[model samples]
Target: MGFLLVLGPLVTLHELGHYLVGRWCGVRADAFSIGFGKELFGITDKRGTRWKISALPLGGYVQFAGDMNPASQPSEEWLALPEQERAKTFQAQPLWQRALIVAAGPVTNLLIAIGILAAFNFAYGKLNIPPVIALVQEDSAAAKAGLDIGDRVIAVNGDPIESFDELRDIVVPNPGTDVDLTVEREGAQKEYSFTIPTLVEQDRFGNEFQVGRLGVGSSPGEIIAVGPVEAITLAFKQTGDIMVMMVQGVWQIITGRRPVDELGGPIKIAKYSGEQLSLGWRQFVSFAALISINLAFINLLPIPALDGGHLAFYAAEALRRKPASARSQEWAFRLGIAFVLSLMVFVTVNDVISLPIFGS
Candidate 1:
């Protein structure tokens, strides 16, 4: 229930971006349903789009007028529509407009994340921990970088580091990559370069990943209030940082550098949502923002049956001066749906196994 509440808003906002942009581009939508299957209730606006909640309560979709179904397949009848009616269909739009409509959904998710993060930073300023080393793991990145106790980290890769957490945000995603560190010790600042080793570690749930280990600890730090400008600025930076981490995580898993088991589905998200809700609204909002960012990034993957997939087709359309043959598109979407459903089943099974009732 908690997960649905969080997910509903994010999903709705994403679809809304598509609907609004499609309208702006003169495309007519047949239905805007917040779930699949039977409709709970709906209303057709003057523009003739049916907006409703569906029984499924899982995810929502926008059915364009010329689309054969929810997957946005261009129908033969749609192709044979009268020239006058074709003007209002999605296929009639120019390549740029079609691409914009398809991309709007993911972009909306990103904007939602930035807004939530900026609000949090403005209301309660983010903490900036001092980069004073408290503990260092032997043979870790910090150890090889010649860092020691009482050494204060000044910068990473020539970028000035203001907090320990900031330093981590830069290092955590770049395992097996070299990082330059400048530290202050004994009244002198010196630079050291070291590689972040790819260390495999497991979470409490036994999900493993290859992560860059700094092998250092720090004390609690003070906080400073950020002005409106800086808050928004930091919010964008934070969003980009999360996006980078998500991309790296996906790449690592695909390349066999990280465990595939770490990939989570709805169940793990629901559990985390419940935990965050228990902590309070702030934590839950942060989690939702993270999820929104992840949704945006994931949807941008060039897989068929997703927004990115649609964009890929549009790219081909632009290049070839025509859309891919309907038969080819159909096959691509079929394979894509099969792959997605299989992944969902696998993740759901993992989620069940990770349940406390089954032994966490």
Candidate 2:
């Protein structure tokens, strides 16, 4: 599956974060796997960690010695280990150290994304697309607001705009909402406040969604090369901007502004992965970068059976000076696993139904 291809490397790197951090905190890993199911090939490293590739290519995990299994249930062998060996176990580590190990996974995913985007910007430079309007649609929001071709967008919501994409970064998500836009025409700057209309558009992949349309288009703009330092700065801002948009998008979906069906799971990702592959290496890499950030954000959520969830427990441990009872942790993890599995099943079925073959 296309999702598996992207998921393999991303997930492996995620687990690697846990493995490396655990080792740094004096915790030993039982295994560092690249995938799930039966092991295909494996070798015990010098550190005595079994590193392996598994049959399923979807995702992976790192198992720390003396730590509870995925279900938060303790392992018998882990419990049976002598006190000296158990001292180096993940469960025996200081609470802060345990927290660091869990946090490392999501942080590493974010780092991978930043590195990828930084490389692209440093190499190809960023497109310098000015906000100069080349076309205006009649009976649209811009037309209604007396916007004309040749008008250049200077600011949106009082924030100065650097590129047309920046203008879009403000407007696209605000469908049917009023915004304050400043434009320059004939050497004079004027402000136009208008309400954007909902524009329902379909992509080449047959996904349909509604977004705010400004009713203005621009011709191809120049590409401006930047020095290494500036490229990294821009890359950071770009990555941060996209992350904010993602969080906003989720909020919109929860508030009923975006469709519930638009919530994608693995199936949608697999389809997009294939499409990106056909587009060329650049687009495929971009997709992977986006997925990387998505993975980081998702894992950081305070849900049960997730890194964020573990971090939440650590936070509690810090306050109480003691960990939660074993029974409570077990119950919490069990409920978290059930919720995650049910959500996956629901989304996978939604993905199948949304396929073009179904015509639903």
Find the 10 residues in a row with the least total lDDT in model 2. 67-76
Stretches of candidate 2 off by over 4 Å are 69-80, 184-190
lDDT of 1 by residue, 1-360 (tens): 779978899999999999999999999999999988999999999999999999977678888778775346557787789888888988778889989999999999999999999998999998978998988889776777678998999999999987899888877777877889899998999988888777777755454556787889888787889999999999999999899888888888798766676788888888878877877888789999999999899788878898998899888888899777778888898888888889889988988887778865
Tens digits of per-residue lDDT for model 2, 211-315:
899889988988878888988888788889988989988998888888778878887899999988888889999999999999999899888799999998889
Q: CA lDDT, every prediction?
A: 0.86, 0.86
TM-score of each: 0.87, 0.90
Off by over 4 Å in 1: 69-74, 134-146, 154-162, 173-212
